[model samples]
Target: MTTSTESPCWFTSSYSDHGGQCVEVATNLPGIIPVRDSKTPGGPVLNFRAEAFAAFVAGIKAP
Candidate 1:
């Protein structure tokens, strides 16, 4: 778990326009992808391997 302060700028997913219930992502880190709740900017962050995070996103969008 990483803190929001430790990550660079984070951006909400485009899908977030549908509602505010979306996760924010920061990819400035070399090998880590920091994710946090958009509603809670200063909340806990879940760090995942960059590759793993990409795969997860792919899976979610897979039909």
Candidate 2:
């Protein structure tokens, strides 16, 4: 289980341009995905396994 401190780059969705209410995602880590609130960068981060993260994103995009 990794933490936000481990991720090097944090990026918010391009859709955030319209509004600031978007989640940020950090990748390039060893085997985890770091996610946090775009509004609170220093806030808590949620870590997920790569496979789990992919599934989560797929779920969000699924109809």
Candidate 3:
């Protein structure tokens, strides 16, 4: 994947624990939501559509 000239502002979930099992997400880019392992900042990133990612999060919160 080609690197974007714009840098993403990554942030870990507020509920993240000290176990280092959390992931980071960057919403600075338009249309895409980038996710990466918090333990590996320089590692590969996974990109998902903004709407799709929102739906996924909602699904996770659903009972």
Candidate 4:
């Protein structure tokens, strides 16, 4: 599948606190989930498979 080279629209989770420690996620890209440290916007981004990201979030949310 062909993926676009478009820029990611990053956003921090609503659950994120005022502390400097946080992560950002951009969901605009299809088939990919880009994550980065909120403190370092210009830093490297970790690209994760959408399905895998979903599973990770599910796991985190699980009791």
Candidate 5:
């Protein structure tokens, strides 16, 4: 969970163009990566390990 003193710098991918269906991710935090829906900024966030998140992104980019 993110502490009150911390705020994630969320950003959406430039490839996102699915009629408002998109996700935002914040990798500024140490060890953890926070993710949330772009459509709902105030909604609940899902946390992932930094390494795991990196792997996921890499996989998506891989052909």
Candidate 6:
């Protein structure tokens, strides 16, 4: 399991543009991508494998 005590550096997409449904992702951690709702910074965070997150993003980018 990937573990990191380092704080996450959250980044929301520029396309979020005032959308209340935005999600933020942290790529600072090793081997995992941490995701949290932009509207709820103190809320629960979902952790996903970096590779899996990469694939998901790729799929979304695909036409």
Q: How many backbone clashes does candidate 2 have?
A: 0
lDDT of 4 by residue, 1-63 (tens): 334559888788888885979999888889999999989999999999999999999999999
Q: Tens digits of per-residue lDDT for model 1 on 1-63? A: 244455477888665684778888887777789898988888998999989998999999999
On a 0 to 100 scale, what is the lDDT of residue 52 in model 6?
A: 100
lDDT of 3 by residue, 9-56 (tens): 888888877578989998878889999998999999999998999999
Ranking by lDDT: 6, 4, 3, 5, 1, 2
The TM-score, computed over Cα atoms with residue i paired to residue i, of candidate 4 is: 0.87
Worst 10-residue lDDT window, candidate 5: 1-10
**Model 6 worst lDDT window (10 residues):** 1-10
Q: What lDDT would each prediction earn against the true structure?
A: 0.81, 0.80, 0.88, 0.88, 0.85, 0.89
Best by TM-score: 4
- Of models 3 and 4, which has the larger lDDT? 4
Candidate 5's error at 50, in angstroms? 0.3
Cα shift from native, residue 22, model 2 (Å): 1.1
The lDDT leader among the candidates is 6
Q: How many steric clashes does model 6 contain?
A: 0
Which regions in candidate 3 have their CA more than 4 angstroms from the true location? 1-5
TM-score per candidate: 0.77, 0.78, 0.86, 0.87, 0.82, 0.86
User: What global local distance difference test value does model 1 have?
Assistant: 0.81
- The regions of model 2 sitting more than 4 angstroms off are 1-6
In model 2, the Cα lDDT at residue 49 comes to: 92
**Clashing residue pairs for model 6:** none
Q: What is the C-alpha RMSD of each candidate to the true structure, in Å?
A: 4.8, 4.2, 4.7, 3.5, 4.0, 3.6
Model 5 agreement with the true structure over 1-63: per-residue lDDT tens digits: 343337898888888875679999886788899899889999999999989998998999899
Q: Write the per-residue lDDT of candidate 6 for residues 12-31, one digit (tens) a residue.
A: 88888867799999888898
Q: Candidate 4 at residue 14, lDDT?
A: 89
